[model samples]
Target chain A: MERILYGDNQFFAVNHLSDSKSQALAVRFKDNEAIIRTLDHAREAGINTFMCTTHDRIAQICDIIRANPEKYKDFKIYPCMPYAHKYANAMTDLGIAGTIKQYVPGNLFGTMFKGGKAFISKDYVSIMELLIDAEMKMFKGIKTPVIFLQNVMTDLLLGLGMVDLLKGYHDYIITKYNAEPGYITMNMPKLLDTLEAAGISNPIICASINKVNFRMSGGKEIYEETLRTRKFRAIAMQVLAGGAIPPKEAIEYVSGLPNVESILFGASSKANIQNTVSTINNFDSNKV
Target chain B: MAVRVALIGAGKMGISHLSILGANSNVEVVGVCDTSKLVLGALQKYTQFPCYTNHSKMLDQAKPDAVVIAVPTKFHYDFVKDALSRNIHVFAEKPFCLHPEQSAELTALAESKNLVNQVGYHNKFVGTFQEVKRLVKEGHIGEVQHFEGEAYGPVVIKKKADTWRSDPSEGGGCLMDYASHVIDLINDILSPVKEAHGTILKTIYSSQVDDAVYSLLKLESGASGLLSVNWSDETYRKMSTSMTILGSKGKIISDANELKVFFKDQKCPQGYSKGWNVKYVTDLAGQVDFYLRGEEYSSQMDYFINTVTGESPNTINNFKSAWITDKAIATIKKSAKNQY
Candidate 1:
């Protein structure tokens, strides 16, 4: 299946989104007409299926898969869950808890998941407990996919052991339930060490690019080093801040670098998609 | 459908406007004028539009429907007044004038002309900021109480000791270049500050310009705001333009990219409760439905052109709003002298 290749996880995230702000499968299904347009554009640009959320829109995505069985059959969906109720319901009914409920302590969006896939957040209050319950339920048929996404501010928070439970919990999930997790990392050099010490391997690490605070050189160097260390399987990219980098230049800039597997780009319109596609397609690796 | 647009001043900001306007569909760069032949000559290659050293000549030949004034702050009043008197819509860059009184006159002139006018406050168009505004309006953070904004970056100085940014006489300083953004954001998100006390750090980087400024603003809605602007950072060339709004129910923190809202209901650890909460939202449809169709230049130009055509609402980036920013700058300068 060529591993159903993608440039980055955000490709999946964006595929799940209607554009950038529509709710996932649990809230509204088949409502994100724009997201379908974007995914179609991505497919035209030579990408296959990626992991994303359907939220309350899960059934709509199912319909999409049913409608175009070959096109979207390989899509990897990861729905987000913030609390116990969402997790519990996902295990059984596969729908998230309604929005008005008092989400479980440490559960961020327990109110949003109507249920389907267990999208476990590392920032949740009782991440360990939530992961344990979610994993147990997923073994019975639910899908629990965890993501570690944070920047410097959250990194400072996680460094204080706020995410330690996640570290231990990830190990337990991958080893016991065959869970495959992913992390969107900032300061790739630093986080690579953390992943190594914990013996965590299944989770893919994405190094976000920040032109000001975290330069591309540092990120690029760390990615190359990690590739050599055999600590990471793939590297996804993100922008820690917003700046106008022409899509063509940005893709050309990263595509030539060593150990870069994918990039998470945010596009506001279809023109951006065309420009970005043209840029990605224009990469000449031999020139590097 | 092309709205003829004229470029005035032909400076760095003017060049940026020209480049972006060139890519817009509804806008056509009809003419560019500047005093310096050097500036005009350099810009000619970037535009197929006519170039003239005189604004009046360019305006006469180009007969532009709109004009973008990107000259120094001192020339803003005269240039804007000239553009508006010609019945042309005006788009001027910030710190509209060197003084509040001057900006007040320009504002009045704009009103009399009744043509579309917008300031180059492009930060408001950013996706995350729009998200913040949406979240705040939706009461995602509850009742607003206090807000704080800060824009910090390393000081820009001249390698040759004669950079225009170092000249205080020409609207060159930390407050003029940067503090306006802080004040604009504060005023836009909250109401204009009713009163403020501020302090500008002088000679932190060099004796040429003040290194930083801090302001304590009192908003018209009784909300308090703390604004800080620093041009000098001992570390790297990183900017952290952040804002936090503390409301009655919860708080929303704008961490540059993400608008994190900490709700009252989410249970937190025994120690770290009621600070900041992260909810992973995966939605692309709503945002992309609007974003995926337009060119960057057209998005902004369309907004400006529609404002001029009266087909869309005229954006409120007038001189009246700029006075609030000028007042904040004055407070910082005054506090710098007192240093209490």
Candidate 2:
């Protein structure tokens, strides 16, 4: 993982702090070239990794990167899946069986046969793998060093006490995709414990870890204790607490924490990107 | 004593509720009922809670103190009626019922039985919207002049095979699935819509139902607003519901994520300034024991569970309030038909 990972939230209109800003960003990045230009800016600022959701639009981003392999040689994408809206819209347009048939990632007969058997046997693991493949279809040639399970699904499975699926996802991403599996969750303490119990030792986990405890489930103290005590690789995200905290204070707080290997953030402008990169670098150098 | 709860319909929302309920120490999930054998099989395999194919049978066998219903809108009436008749507290998903009459009947039945009843209008639990309600009530934006409520999403982007969402009888369409949320928010934030005019239920993709709904709603307070909702908008990643209120003094724009208020003078509320004030959901949202998707989902469930356990009063999101939203829907539908 890169020390600084660029997030795709701003590009996708997912501003947790303000919707108007999100709308502005949505307009700003409406064209693919604009997204490419901003990404180039991030790359210039010494950030190579893009942690993004597997939205349909990201497929176009992947196409652009694929076309310019020389320019994006060091650029990496960490895809988070499955994008809930894609499945939701697909489920609405097509029935459950039809959605599975459409996205199961194989010949119709093979997909149907496997989908039929999975449905009959209630083999959720197979279904999960199939969906992962389908989500990964867009990032075929890109360098996805890490694949993440979005919090919506990750926390759901955790809340459901389905540790086996978490374990299944971990094993499948490693064995099939040959990438380190990362879990993005709201509850870091609970997910860390669950992942450890599922035999995934020292797993890579991304979560909201900031001064304000914005979306940090199980409270901030517990998260701090977990980061200090646990062996997992922590990717501190939402460190600014959705703009509640000053960037310097947020970075300082997260950088002072234990075992946070990476910091993930999203910004639209080159100045903001450059400012954040310098802030993180300054804090890291001061810490060292 | 934990509130023994039984869940009916283990679909998307149902499963979410089940997870939240299962995590709540104040609630004990005794049974789960769904029609799909596959869903039931998976639940049976994964969770220890008893699973059933029939709701009535589950109610009889599990004998829960409360029941959470997340079936389609068409089944809401029958399922809620069944639960209420059995003298069980009910938490049904919105748009409360298929018709206002059905909702009224259920409301009366639940009230007569003194059973705690709640409709899952989860937006009310959203912090920004909750803040919007508080600001509006405090006259922060002054007397409201006009408002615009909108909800856009990519639910139906293309011509496709009919699902329960596209079927009008199943409480499909922008009116029920999408607009009901905005309408409910408008009704709660302002007042119940007493009349609607210039209604246009346009179909962009779905054949049987309207993919978009537009109308002029007259609130009971005599304040009128524009209602615009479209489900076929591919630009939105998900359903984005917002309200822009133009008041005599200033204006307020709010969505699920943030609230922006503009005041004419320095007579602003505490923590807010004159020119423009912004607040994020993180600052306003209440904490929940278990969270999924958004805090609102867990907050709403916690509210219902607390209400059911007599720990909290049944004030917000009760059946009576949801009935008003149903009535608003009925008014919008009638206005669309009487198009002049």
* Lowest lDDT block of 10, candidate 2 chain B: B36-45
Tens digit of per-residue lDDT, candidate 2, span B1-340: 9899999988778888888887677888899998765567667777778989899999999999999999889999999999998999999988899899998998899999999999999999999999999989988888888999999888888888778988989998889988999999998999899999999999887789998999998898878899999888988877889999998788999999888899899888899888888888889988665668889999888888888878889888999999999999999998897322
List the lowest-lDDT window of 10 residues for candidate 2 chain A: A113-122
lDDT of 2 at B245: 94
CAPRI verdict (incorrect, acceptable, medium, high) for model 1: incorrect
lDDT of 2: 0.87
Candidate 1 interface RMSD, angstroms, 1 decimal: 25.7
Every model's DockQ, to 2 decimals?
0.02, 0.50
The weakest ten consecutive residues by lDDT in model 1 chain A span: A91-100
Model 2: what TM-score? 0.95
Count the clashes in each prediction: 43, 0
lDDT of 1 by residue, B180-255 (tens): 7777877777677677765545556445665567777788878887877775652322344667888777777763
